[model samples]
Every structure is written in structure tokens, then in C-alpha cells.
Target: MKLTVVGGGSTYTPELIDGFARLRDTLPVEELVLVDPATERLELVGGLARRILARQDHPARVVTTADLDAGVADADAVLLQLRVGGQAARNEDETWPLECGCVGQETTGAGGLAKALRTVPVVLDIAERVRRANPDAWIIDFTNPVGIVTRALLKAGHRAVGLCNVAIGFQRRFAGLLGVDPSEVHLDHVGLNHLTWETGVRLGGPEGEDVLPKLLAEHGGPLAETLHLPRAVLDRLGVVPSYYLRYYYAHDEVVRELRTKPSRAAEVAQMERELLRMYADPALDEKPELLARRGGAYYSEAAVDLAAGLLGGGGSTYQVVNTYNNGTLPFLPDDAVVEVQAAVGPQGASPLPVRPVDPLYAGLIANVTAYEDLALDAALRGGRERVFRALLAHPLIGQFEYAETLTDRLIAHNREHLAWA
Candidate 1:
């Protein structure tokens, strides 16, 4: 099967390449295309990708190109991992929101809205071209603001599923702590992308015995530490919240912390520079250890599993993915995209039934879903008013003054990317 990675130039590509090399038997990739507008980074990543595959004795032909249409043409699947405005824009996304005393994050609050606005249109255009190239091809989005982007793709009628490393990362972590293989550990992961909770940790399958309480009872300290939350919070909730939730559970504290530290974008930019230098080494045949610090932990594994499942290859029958709710959560609209454990196959993902959500989480999920609706609207039909409204709707930036200021800062920093601006 053929596969295409639209942002193959990204520093994250090597991790993905490593997975494709190791999991060849699962996905059985024949041709792999790396599509990117940045020719220099593309070549560096592409060379490393080839060397990694060759060292592993994988026979997939690796191709690199700047032409999106040509790169995706006739591919069996296309994976979207592009950052529309690069790290510089991300720096702005992460910095400007802090000025409003809000969490400065790439996929939450004002920063997330900015990312959604800049990303959705570009992703849509790529999806449209991919649709034209191979109507049967599946689109796997690993881009930030995945819920909004995936919603755009699906609403436009593209064959798509959204993948995030959060669930897989949690699976691997829980397995390590439980002294079991990752596959044997199943997470009752639910909620929207980047805003999810592990309600239960089952062993064997979806119906397997729930061992979440056991995990919390024994491993709550480390788990809470990883999430940057207090152990008491986990014990109180009886569920492990994704690290991203720290932004919500401790908004003011997070904003204060963000203000003191350098933006994640800046740190990543420095890391990418070092990573690119490393990628250029002809002797480097494996993904560098530094890439792990660059984030997207276990992204390669998640991508491989999702792609394999979507293409009807050997893959996990149930995985956490972002897809239409379709009433999986009675509180969310049917069309709203949510991240949850689902049965995945060539027919697409069907979310498994979820237990009744506690009002604590359900209220937040519903609030964010509404904000995402406005974010998508501003992304699709850009306007100052739309941007302001979306910002105001966000739980993190509900005040009009902050929303107004953030809207201007977002548009000002991103005017070149926003056509309407």
C-alpha cells in the first residue's frame, strides 16, 4: 500500500519513518511520499527516512516533493502533519495568549483558535486535492487542532480519521507501570482531542476488567506527576486527565508558569535546528534520541496502527481516535468530533458506547465543543467578529476584554496567513 505524509519535512517525520520501518509487516507500505513546501528540511528528513528504512531492510520506495498534488496522487493514504505557519507563528500563538492571562498553548485557548484558523483552510485544500487524486484514499490528520481540522475534512466529505499520540502515550505508560504489554492495556479514553480523560484502564479488550482503580491506588503519584497535577486531584476524580487538562484545571497557575518560561515554540525551534543538524549526518540511520524531547511521544506507533486499521491491514480492532460523536456522548452534538476509543476499520471509526459522563467532565466537553464550532466557523469564513466570538466562547478566555484583545493579537500576528485580515 502507498502512503503519503504531507509535512514529511517536519522534525517529527523521523519518528514516523522509524515506526514505518519497524511496523512494515503491519502496514505493508509499498511507496512512501514525503510532501513539503520547505525543500531543504524535506531533503534532510527524506534522506534520513531512506537510510532508516534501508538499515531495517524495508523495501518501500521513498519519494520527496514540493508538489502536494503530485506527492499525494494515487496514494492509498495521506497523513497530514503540517504546521501551517511554522514555529514562528506558533511562538506568537503561545506568547500572545499569555498576555491575556490565559493559558498559552498550541492546541488550547486563543493559541488553539489561531492554529485552527491558519490550519483548517490549508488542510481542507489538501484534502480536496487528495480527494481528486484518489477518491478511495484515506486521510489521517495528525495536525494540531485535530478536532477542528478533522471536522473540516469529514464535513467536506473526505475519507478521514484523526490521530493523536495522547492515547497511545498513555497506553504505553500505563502498560509500563502495570508490567504488561501495551496492547493488553486498553484505555476508556473519552472527550475531545487534547481535552480527554482516561475514565478506565481495561485489560485484554474494551470489555476487559477495568483496572483503573488499581492503577490509581498504586501508581497515582507518578501519573499525577506526569500530568503536572497534584496526586490528590487524581484520587478525587478517580480518572487520569491528559496533561493538556492542566491548562484548564489550573488556568491561572499555568498562565503564570507560561509567562515565566520561554515559549514551547522557541524551545522546539532550537530543538529542530539541532535535529536538522543531526538529520544531516549521513551516519545517522535511526531517529535521534533528541526527537523524543521534541515531543509527540509514540506518534509513530499511533500513526502506524491507525493507518493499518484504516487500510484493512493488521491493526488493533479498537483504538482512540477523533471522529464524529454520533451520540457516543449524549451531551455532544451528533456531528461534533470527539476523541474516544472506537472500533476502527476500512469503513471508518465507530465510537464505542461510553458510560454516562460525570457532569464535571461533560460540562467542560460541551463548552469546548461549542467553542470549537465557532473556531471552525472563523476558520472557514474568516472575519474579525467571528474570531472575537470564538475567543469569547472559549472557557479559558470567556471575558470580552481578553477575547477582544486576543482576537486582534491573533489576527495581527497572523494577518499574512488570514486572507480576510
Candidate 2:
């Protein structure tokens, strides 16, 4: 199979290459294309990818190209990981929201909406090109604000499924805590992407015993620490919220903490500098340990499992993916995309039915679903009023004054990328 990565120049590529090499038997990619507009980083990252594959004796030929059309042509699957304006833009996304007294984050607040507005059109254009090049191909999106982007792609009728590592990361952590293989842990991961909780953690299979209460009873303190949430909150909710929830649950405190530290974008930008320098070393044939610190733990495994399952190679894997709700959560519109555990195969992913949701979580999910509707509108149609409305709808920035201020900042920071502006 031929697989193409759109942002192949990313520092994260080696981690992916490492997975493709180690898990070669699962997906068996014959050709790998690294597509990026930046030539220097592309060569460095692509060269390292080749080295990683060669070290593992994998036969997948690595191709590097600045041409998106050429890179994706006739490919079996295309992975979207491109950043619209790079980390400099992300730095802006993380900082400017603080000017409005909101938590500064990449995927959850005013910041995430800015990213969506800048990213959706570009992704749609790329999806169109991918469609023309290979209609049979599946597009696996690993972009930020995934629920919104996946919704846009599905709305436009593209064959797409969004992937995130949140569930896999939790699975790995739980497996370690339980002294079992990661595959043996199945998460009742539900809600929208990034805004999800682990309501249950079943062992062995979907029908296996629910050990969530047991896991929490013993590991609550450590688990809460991992999520940066209070143990009391976890005990009260009887669920574990994704780390992104910290931005919502402790917005003001997080804002204060964010004010003290340098922006996360700045830290990543520095890390990229070091990672590129490492990639330039001809002796480096394996993924650098530093890459682990770059985040997105277990992303490669998630990608491989999803691709293999969707292509009919890997049989019947239950994975967490962002796809249409299809009434899995009756409260959400069937067309709305949700992140949950599903049975994945050649036919595509179908979310397993969810147990009755508590009103506490269901209410928030419904509110965010409504905000996402408006957010997609602002992202696609592009008006100041639409942007303001979307911002106003966000639970984190519900007040009119903050929404108005953030809307202006978002537009001002991303004017070059936003055609309507």
C-alpha cells in the first residue's frame, strides 16, 4: 500500500516512520510519501525516515516532495497533519486569548476556533485534490480541532475519519497500571474530540467486565495528576476527563498558570529546532528519545490500526475514532462527528452504542455540539458576526465583550490566512 503524509516535514514524522517500520506486518506500506512545502525540513525529516525504515529492513520506499498533488496521487491513504501557519501562528493562538481573561490553549477555547478558521479551507482544498487523485483512498485527519475539521470534511462529502491519541494514551496508561497489554484495555471513551471522558474501561473486550470504578478507586490520585484535575472532581464525576478539560474546569486558575509560563508554542518551536538538528545527523537511524517529549504519545499505533482496519488488512479492531455519531449519543445530531470507541473494518468505523450518559456530561456535550455548529459556520462562511457568535457560544468565553475582543484578535492575527478578512 502507498501512504502519503501531507505535512511530512513535521518533526513528528520520525515517530510515525518508526511505527510504520516496527508495525510493518500490520499495515505493510510499500511506498511512503512525505509532502511538505518547506524543502529544507522535508529533506532532513524524510532522510531520517528513510534511515529508520532501512534500519528495520522495511521495504517501503520513501519519497519527498513539495508538490501536494504529485505526492498524494494514486495513494492508498492520505494523512493530514499540516499546520496552516506553523508554530508562530500557534504561539499567537496560545497567547492572545489571555488578553480576554480566558485560558490559552491550542485545541479548546478562542484559540481552537482561530485554528479552525485558518485550517478548514486549506484542508478542504487538499481533500478535493486527494479526491481527484484517488477517490478510493481514505483520509485520516490528525489535525487539531479534529471534531470541527472532520465535520467539515464529512459535510463536504469526503471519505474521511479523524484520529486522535487521547484514547490510546489512556489505554496505555491503564494497561501499565493493570499489568496487562494495551490491547486488553478498552475505553468507554465518549464525547467530542479533545473534549471527552473515560466513562468506563473494560478489560479483554467490549463485553468484558467494567473495571473503571476499580481503576479509579486504586489509581485516582495518580490519574487525576495525569489529567491535571483534582482527585475530588474525578471522584465526584465518576469519570476521567481528558487533559484538555483542565482548560474548562479550571479556566481562571489555568489562565493564571499560563500567564507565568512561556507559551507552549514557544517550547515546541525550540524543540523543533533541536529535533531538526538531530534529524540532520546521518548517524541517526532510530526515532530520537526526545521525540517522545514532543507529545502525541501512541499516535503512530493509532494511525496504523485505523489505516489497517479501514483498508481491510487488519481484521476487526476496536479503536477510538472520530466519525459520525449516527445516534450513538441520541442527544447529538446523527451528522455530528464524535470521538468514541468503535468497531473498525473495511466498511469503516461504527461507534459502539453508549450507555446512558449522566446529565452532568450530557449537558456539556450538547452545549459544545451547538457551539461547534456555529463554529463550523464561522469557519466556512466567514463573517465577523458569525465569528462573534461562535465565540459567544463557547462556554469558556460566553460573555459578549470577551467574544467581541477575541473575534477581533483572531481575525487580526490570522488575516493573511482568512480570505474574507
Candidate 3:
């Protein structure tokens, strides 16, 4: 099996290689191509893979290339980890948007659409290359705004899968909170990437309404106390939510309990800075096993293995992933791809086709989905109008004037970054 990483220059590349290498004992893919625009960065990952090979019982030859086509051609599996605007630009992307009172979260809402606007062109270019070079290769995209980006890929007619590690980490958190082994928890979650909810989680068996609420009562614990979300949402809404759900509701109610702008803005900004520091610190790299540890922290093995298996053998595996919505939910627009588990394989991804959600909450979420759609439209079509729509329609942005002001400021602030369509 030939496996390639399109953006092997990323900080996460080593850990991803570690993922493939660790799975080598089980899945046994033969060749790995580390491709990046920067030769030096690709070499860095190649060196790490080589070191792992030197230590291993079986060492696969690792190739580093600056050429994307060379790396992707004739490959069986491809993992994309590219940062199109780079981390610095991403920081600006969030900050500028937040100054507009746009909530400024990555890979969700209008921010996600803005991210896709600049990124989709590049990603679609890669997809084109994959089509020309290795038509059969399954592209496992790890890019942000996964659902939105994947929609572009699908619109372009490529074989790819959208993946987010949020589900894996949350499931493990549920495991820890519930006092059950992580492996023992049967789970189901659905919604767009980042902002999703655990529809159901049970100890053993599936398909009982009684089982669902009981599991939440036991397993939804304080997002393991690190995140203010799952706990806060559970406390108020009577249900645990995906971690990023905090951005959806009023921040004042969740953590600092402040409803106004400046204070909430300050608190949110501090949160971003704090999180970015954890990632940007070079000293942390000296720890040797941070990526490997983090990969485990997310419980990525199940999802990773599922894709590898699907590619190799074509057995159907159920997994929650971001993809184009072709009527997966009864009321959700056919164009909006909400995240949900599905039976997947060589043909492509298909949504599991869940029933219409309960009336009270689903309508509210559909409104959120509308914002996501506007986000996608704004990014892909590249207009001030769609941007205004996304902000104006957002669940968080609230009032009309605030949304318009935000739209104006964010568009002006990120002008150089935006497509200017």
C-alpha cells in the first residue's frame, strides 16, 4: 500500500506519520511519500519516519519530495494537512473577524466559510492533481471547515473523506467521565464540524430512548473539566454538546457569565491566545512524544483505522464525518452537508439518513446550519452580500446592526486575505 501526506511540512505531520507507522503492525502500508512545498520541512518529517524505521521491527522506505504530483501519484491513500494561509494568517483570520464581533472561531460558522474561500481553490487544485495522477486514491482531508471544503471537493467530483478529531477526543472524554473503559461506550453524534451534539451514547447496547438520557446523565461530565461547554450546555439545555458548542450560546451563560461585548470579547481573545501558546511553544517539542501523546488523547486510532480498512478492503464502517448534505436530514437543505456517521467505502461517503430531529431544538440548529450555508456561499462565491448574510443570520451575532457592523469591519480588515469577489 502506498500512503502519502500532501502537506507533510505541517507540525502535525510527524504525529500523522506516527499514526501510519504505528498502524503498520496492523494495516501494513508499504510506501510513504512526504510531500510539501518546502524541501527542508519535508526532510524533517522524512528524518523522523526514518528514525522510527531504524527502531522498528519493520522499516518502510520513506520518501520526501517538494513535488506534490510526484508524492500523490499512484498512491493508495492520501492525507491532507496543509495550512493554506499558514498558522500566522489563520491567527489573523480569527482576530480580524472577532473584531467584527463575528465570533472568530476556526472551521465553523462564517469564519469557516472565510477559511474555505481562500483554501478551497488550493484544495480543489490538489484534488485535480489527484484525479490526474491517482484517480483511485482516497483523499483523507484534515483541512478545517471540513464540511464546507469537502462540499467543494464533492462539487468537483473527487473521491475524498472529511475527518475531524473532535469526535474521537469527546468520546474518550465521555468514557473517562462515565467511569467506563473508553472502548465500552457505544456512541452517536451528529451535526456540522465543531458545533455538533451527542445524539446518543450508551454503555453497551444501542437504540433505546431510555438509554440515551441515562448515558448523558452519567457520562457528560464537565467536558472532563477542561472545556466549559459539555457541562454548561448540559446544565442549561439538559444535554451535553460538542465542545465548540460554547461558541453557539451566550458566553456569559457558559463561563465568565458576562453578556456584553468588551468583556466577552476580552475573555474570548484570552482563550485563543492561551490555546495558541500551547501549540506554538517550541519548548514543548523537546518533550519527544507530544504528538504521539496527543494522537492518543484524541483516540484517533479508531477513525484512522476505519478509513484505512475501508480503502483496503471496502467493508462498510459507520463513522461521523463531514461531507456534502444530499438530504441526510429530512429538513436540512440538500446543499448543506451536516456531519453524521455513514456506511463508507471505495464508491464514496454517504450520510446515514437520520430521522428529522425533535421540533423544539432542531429548528434552532437548522438556523445555525443556515449560517453555515451562508458561510460556504460567501467563501465560494466571494461577495460582501453573502458575508453579510452569514453574519446577519448567525445564532451568536444576534441583532441586525451588530451583524452588519461586524460584516463591514471584518470584510475591510481581512480585505487582503479575502477573495474580493
Give the candidate number with the greatest lDDT.
1
* RMSD vs true structure, all candidates: 0.7, 0.8, 4.7
Tens-digit per-residue lDDT, 1-421, candidate 2 = 9999999999999989999999988999999999999999999999999999999999999999999999999999999998999999999999999988997887888999999999999999999999999998999999989999999999999889999999999999999999999889988898999899999999998888999999899999999998888899999999999998888898889999999999999999999999999999999999999999998788999999999999988633799999999999999999999999899887778999898888888988988998999999999999999999999999999999999899999999999999999
Whole-model lDDT, model 2:
0.93
- Count of backbone clashes, every candidate in sequence: 0, 0, 3
Candidate 3 TM-score, C-alpha based: 0.82
Per-model lDDT: 0.94, 0.93, 0.65
Candidate 3, pairs of clashing residues: 252-257, 252-258, 325-337
By TM-score, the better pick of 1 and 3 is 1
Query: What is the total number of backbone clashes in candidate 1?
Result: 0
Q: What would you estimate as the lDDT of candidate 1?
A: 0.94
| Stretches of model 3 off by over 4 angstroms after superposition | 177-183, 203-215, 219-221, 230-232, 252-287, 292-303, 314-316, 353-356, 412-421
Cα lDDT tens digits, model 1, 324-352, are: 99999998899999999999999999999
Lowest summed lDDT across 10 adjacent residues in model 3 is found at 255-264
